[model samples]
Target: MMAQPLLCEVLIDPERAKGLSLQQWDLLIRQARHADLLARLAYLLEGQSGVPTAAQRHLDSAWTFAQRQAQSVRYEVASIQKALSDLGIPVVLLKGAAYIMAGLPAAPGRLLSDIDILVPKPCLERVENGLLLYGWRTTHHDEYDQTYYRQWMHEIPPMKHGVRGTVIDVHHAILPPTARLKPDSSKMLVAAVALAAEPGVCVFSPVDMVLHSATHLFHEGELEHGLRDLVDLDALLRHFGDQSGFWEQLVERAVALDLVRPLYYALRYTAQMVATPIPPFVVKALDKLGRPSALISSLMDCLFARALRPSHVSCDSQWTALARWMLYIRSHYLRMPFHLLFPHLIRKAVKKRQGSGSLTEPIVVKE
Candidate 1:
């Protein structure tokens, strides 16, 4: 058996898996699955020779499942595009859907649970009504929940297709309306590029896509999938960084969008953890935009390094839990002011205790 490779190393350099024992392979597969990265591992190892038969079988199975899911998601997206076509709404895909629709390298072997689309805020109501008419209904029917989303949330309450059971998140903005930093949605819409293959389907410009991904990852409360999200950032940078002038454009756009902080953290951590190659000039430019203090930087490094690792039993530690909680609190703090956050947290806690609120809360409708 060869020496056991670290998770990051195995991802970056699949040849490192050459001589692993069956037990080691098992552990790696389990860890990758737990991190929502099994399909990515499959993609990396598919063409490599000398993989153990058992590991090969696991990889094949994972790849097949991922491909099936990706197809379904694409079909759902097409149907959605058709449904909203008559409204003349320019449907801008976000996150997983965006990567897949744009045919980015990050698309293959990706798993998607919900389809996210952004429309202009002015047409949000019309879009919702159109979706409802097409058999997509809100999942939540509670009055307070409906009010909460309309008043403060970035997206409407998630809707599900009546017949297909597909979930969709319709957004008019990237961040919550109440967030301290609001990127100009209209500007993002203006810069969106139309998909050549799919009429009415569009995606963010490369720079804005990276900014939005960074913002989503850093501002999210959930850390269980932090590792997966980081991997996405790494993949995105590698794919888009190959273009000439990409780095300069990315930095300028981040400044224009007030998203330099998230870009800084994304570049910093991807460089540290995944050995992502970042240009020195880009680093210097971002540093001039305001780098964190040494103490704060050190603290965040500790927290993120731990939280962004695979969240399997073998990886668990007291420090990991503490770091995740701290980051969770930090995410909420970044999302809203204390005056709003306190009550929001309290309401969430109450809902959780009552077993009424889950990560995917159903939309509430009133009579």
Candidate 2:
């Protein structure tokens, strides 16, 4: 086994990587790639003399690949904008697309698997029809699956372009209609900022952008890329934290949007795991917004700490799987009431056991 420093710590101070052997560097690269941070790692190591020549080559290759992929994603976004322009719908870019369009620090060296956009619920049908007319087709064809997405889910069924095979997720809201936290999607749309570079594209406001990222990371059952998501949070904080009054506005916006808890968790974990620089007074103010009790927080700390690490075999432990499962259950519970959740879980389990292809599970594409 190779001795490894914490990846986040190494990213913060690449000089600390001076003494790592080629084999250890190989391990680090593999772990970083698995966590979808390879290109970001490459970006951080640029111009650093401490990295081995061979390792530097690998990082450069990763960086090249990321740049090419980002370019392709931009093309796709342009096509989507054209597809929806006739409808005159306000297309709000979400997640990776938003990061790229806004030219955030989180954008460069970030690998995007698919594009995500949001439109008003009333305009969803028109947007969907326009996409299909422009050669995009629903990845899910089953009636049950289609109904499930339309009735309960926040987004329409995933669609892929017929010729290019590029996937896209079109969301009408950030959370499911059945979710416990009913964030006002209209307000989010109203507050969105237009991208100067992209005429038809808009992105969430600075504060809402962070809130949505936190909500996506914490609310989802998947932990495979939790650490990468944390890295994104760290980058967003470091980049935006520089502006005067940013922290206060973030806290205030979170409160206005009823997203204080997710912001609290985002701050707590990023500070704990990656040493993200959060202000003392900001933390103090958010602490008053009803953080989880000490016992629950401690338990969450253990689960998240284990789950957020790279999912490499060398890092695996018996407790990690249990922690992931617990968080998975907790995520669904948070999203839906027990009455709806129990039946949903049972149906999913039965479908998995039966090996049915009719109902495909939602795929979380990284970017």
**Candidate closest to the true structure, highest lDDT:** 1
- C-alpha local distance difference test of each model: 0.85, 0.84
Candidate 2 lDDT by residue in tens digits, 103-164: 89998888767788989999999999999998999998878789888888899999999988
Give the clashing residue pairs of candidate 2, or none: 111-367, 112-367
lDDT of 1: 0.85
- Candidate 2 deviant stretches above 4 angstroms: 1-5, 356-367
Regions of candidate 1 where Cα sits further than 4 Å from its true position: 1-5, 356-367
Relative to the unseen true structure, what is the C-alpha lDDT of residue 210 in candidate 2, on a scale of 0 to 100? 88
Across 155-225, the per-residue lDDT of candidate 1 in tens digits comes to: 99999999888889999998887777778888998899999978988999998899999998988889888
**At residue 41, what lDDT does model 1 achieve?**
91
